[model samples]
Target: MLNALDNLTRLISFDSVSKNSNEPISDYVSSLLEELNFEVERTTYMDARGVLKCNLLACRRPLSSHPKLDETQSSSASDEETSPKNAPGGLAYFCHTDTVTADRWTGPGGDPFSAIVLDGRVYGRGACDMKGSLVAFLDAARKTPHEEQKLPLWIACTADEEVGFEGARFLTENSNAYTELVAADPVSIIGEPTMLHVIHAHKGICGMQIRSQGHAAHSSTDMGVNANVAMVPMLQTLLEIHNRCLTDEALRNDAFDPPTLTWNFGVSDGMKTVNIVPDHSNAWASMRTMPGVDGKDIIEQVKRRADELGLTFTLYSGGDPMHTDAEAPFIREFCELASTYIGPNSPEAVCYATDACAFGQLQHRVVCGPGSISQAHTTDEFIEIEQLETGIRFYEDTIRRWCC
Candidate 1:
């Protein structure tokens, strides 16, 4: 527990904010992995401004097949089926090393990066949102018996998960560190704040922006068309679309709370002054589509509706929703391991999104970790001491079950 807390403190102090360069924290993680007798592969790439950003792929040396499993074992019998010797097909843990901006932190005393402990809770940015999981994973690796870990154990510490999935996108496309890992399609555990619950299904997110244009003229003139007025009906149409999605039985997925597509117009802009007719207006909306809902179809519907209103629309960005077989053995085994401490609980469907949505594209993935998602990105973010200890033990047990 103390070792895990120490690593968490060290990690939180680095201030690896999403908009800043992650070189320092990346180097620190690489150094720590090296000290644990793991070979580190750092995949470096330049961001839009040519600043260096990196993702670290570290795996235990002498990666091997499942020596602990019997030779006659089948894939149905165990999630860690035997693979070619030294192949990357085995247990892997994923976590984003970058954190959201801490400028909004309103906690008393020390700032977000102070890594302070108050009343059995560690207060800091990214403490619960995820630096704690990384620390727990590292500490667990340090305590694992070398001989017990017979299969490959890999860690992917990625960047740019907050603003965009660029880090994960780059790693999957360009990195050679885990070609076999992807090919083998190993069970992946994404460490996100889930209150130690196993998440097997969640909605995917995508966004679009609609811009309205009109000729600008003074209010006293009759030649002007109001972009704001043109946009109002389109906005109402979007609400109608939302209402339609809510009523569409075919678009429902019971796993999610609303069981339907959810949309929010997060940003809307128009005229700056009341006297002048606005020439331009735009609304940025986010859509969270349930798994099995065709995001492209939704976009097409919006496009057609916009065409009826004579409005131009653009898809700024978005990510697909993801789902893993709820009955997968790996998920069952993971939940079983967690149940030992926290008692039995079933896999849940969460509304929150994570890097798991990105990694789930390549493999079977589940999101589980200590702390609550409610605390993530809050002004006073924190992780309880008890949860941290439980997380360390959970990670240690996971390594033993899959690697050993």
Candidate 2:
């Protein structure tokens, strides 16, 4: 088997921060898969700065010369005909190549571009958050025993996950090639320093920016409407809605600890000077909700409150809620494998969102990967060497069981 940790070090060395560009890292991954003789497809998003940024979908089988067979029959024939040469019905391993900006902490370990291995952990921007899992999946594909069963495996290295899951959204809207998916994002793993746990569910997120407009004037003048001052009522209304969501028993999920809904006001605009009555003001807020509550409902309620306050607002970004049955066959199998390889009782639920929501909506059986959310996007971000090795083994074994 390829050394997963070594591969992880190399992956972490690339600076794929969300705002900058992931084209370099995406190129590296494409080259690696290409070297393995996998047919790579690059799906690029145009709006992103790194226009070269792409979602790399790699598979071992070449498309049929004639497009005449049904999906089931084609998959079956692919399995039988390519049994000795390639893999079977597509089983995809998905991960995002982009990361949140690494600007919080700076110093020796601050520069995320410089990946370092100290002690037994690999340190860099995307180490534990993601790049580690990407490497592990690639390593698994490289070393797994696919010749026996010859089940086709796909790797989806997407971009813009940190921003708004645009890459995943694009893939979901465009592709129907795979029936099974595994989103290798860290939060789903429950911030476990070990690879013993497999997460099956996570909350969904909805981000929004609210802007209000009015007439601008000096503080001493009451002739003009003060947009900044007007913001207070709307903010209060949102806070009330957020607090109500927290207290409402109906929104709570027994599966999650202290489950309800999460919201935070992250940013505000306008009102730069104390004496000026700002003409426009805006605020950014996000919500994390359980499967039962549609994010649209919450947004509508916010809009209703805004309307009641006579303010105008718009939805900057939004995402749907997702929940998959923990007893799903693939999830059960993965749980069993995790238990066998790492420990017993290995399933978990997380509160953060992931690309699994997108795949899950597409009816694909999805699960989270190894590593911890705690170490993600932090200074000196790292994943234990042991965790990396164990994750690779788990992935290899899982691939072998299903594909071989």
Candidate 3:
């Protein structure tokens, strides 16, 4: 309710990059949610760097006192609507407060955190990737009066989604509010940059690395061992996997662009000069995991290859794909709502994963919000004013349909 545009501007200034502690921005968001009469739930955890990060789940119920859950009840929608007023069933929205680094900011002002509105677009570090969507949903939820909310409304803000969905995973496993949200069987939306289209499925991500260590010595010395030599076999195995994925129809999902599990790799050695034998070498590989592909098998194969060569293999991440029935009744209804604004359409699929990856416990969920995905994490990220306004109406309609 406190000026939404001003909130967007303020959020952009926080510099809540994935590496930095998001406590400052979380504090401001918690205060705003509290002001909106939501009972704010907080979860805090230290990152690998030991910096404290926070996740928030704010619940706002109807004006009718507090709603307590009934153990004997199932989370069926028809039963829930008539079961109890101010019950823990309705709508929920999710957004991550962190953004990718802006080290390469090339906007007009050359400062990523200094939000600027130019030519009807708001530009900043997270203007489109997510801060804009977060503000949009918060504003819409606040617009709905407490009296209209027959069921509870939930707004969740997470940390470290861009890095590895750590905050979301932590919240789902640790937060009491998250348990209630999942139990309520509420329809949830992950407000990633989706150009306002309803998304029912998305690809997952996987990362792996192989490292080899050797003693460093001058290139002219005969006693030196090059770690890169040990990595040669692992690199070949990676190429084989990548080539197979490129043409493997069994691993493809036509719903996504390019359809196949895309692969990329990077090899690095610490040696600054080629004249020295590298003491250590590492080869990192990542791939997009589609629904049908067995990502775990691919990881195991790479690990075995590394082990056969006496190299250290690390599984940076397993695939965490999110998929819901595209033909489900709730999904159909949500798509209808989206069509009212964007004109006739069906639910979509995205190649990129979202915080939804960690929220698999929730039954009914979708990914949809304002802004095009192309602008996310770019040097000059911006969200058009039109898209932001449209996003508010879409989210408000979502809230009214379930909560009111």
Q: By TM-score, who's the top model here?
A: 3
lDDT of 1 by residue, 168-262 (tens): 87888777766646654556788898878889888878888888888888989988887777788888877877777778887778889978777
lDDT of 3 at 318: 49
lDDT of every model, 2 decimals: 0.78, 0.66, 0.86
| Tens digits of lDDT, candidate 3, 42-99 | 9999999998999999988778745754543225533223444323368899999999
State which candidate has the highest lDDT: 3
Q: After superposition, how far is residue 121 of candidate 2 from its true place, in Å?
A: 0.6
- So what's the TM-score on candidate 1? 0.89
Q: Which ten contiguous residues of candidate 1 have the minimum total lDDT? A: 69-78
lDDT of 1 at 338: 82
Residue pairs in collision within model 1:
204-321
For TM-score, candidate 1 versus 2, the one ahead is 1
**Which stretches of candidate 1 lie above 4 Å from their native place?**
48-51, 63-88, 215-225, 270-272, 308-310
TM-score of each: 0.89, 0.85, 0.95
Off by over 4 Å in 3: 71-88
Q: Residue 245 error for model 1, in Å?
A: 2.1
- lDDT by residue (1-404, candidate 2, tens digit) is 23677667677778788776678888888888986667777777675454555677776542332222234322222212234222224455778988878776452466676777788787788888788888877787778644543445567778888777788778766654432222211112212233547776667887777777878778788876777676788888778877877788776776776587776774364455777677787876787877786557778887887788777767765555566567655566667888866667645677777776565533333555677778777766777777787777877776676556
The runs of at least 3 residues in candidate 2 whose Cα sits more than 4 Å from the true structure, single-residue gaps closed, are 1-3, 48-52, 62-90, 106-110, 175-196, 220-224, 266-269
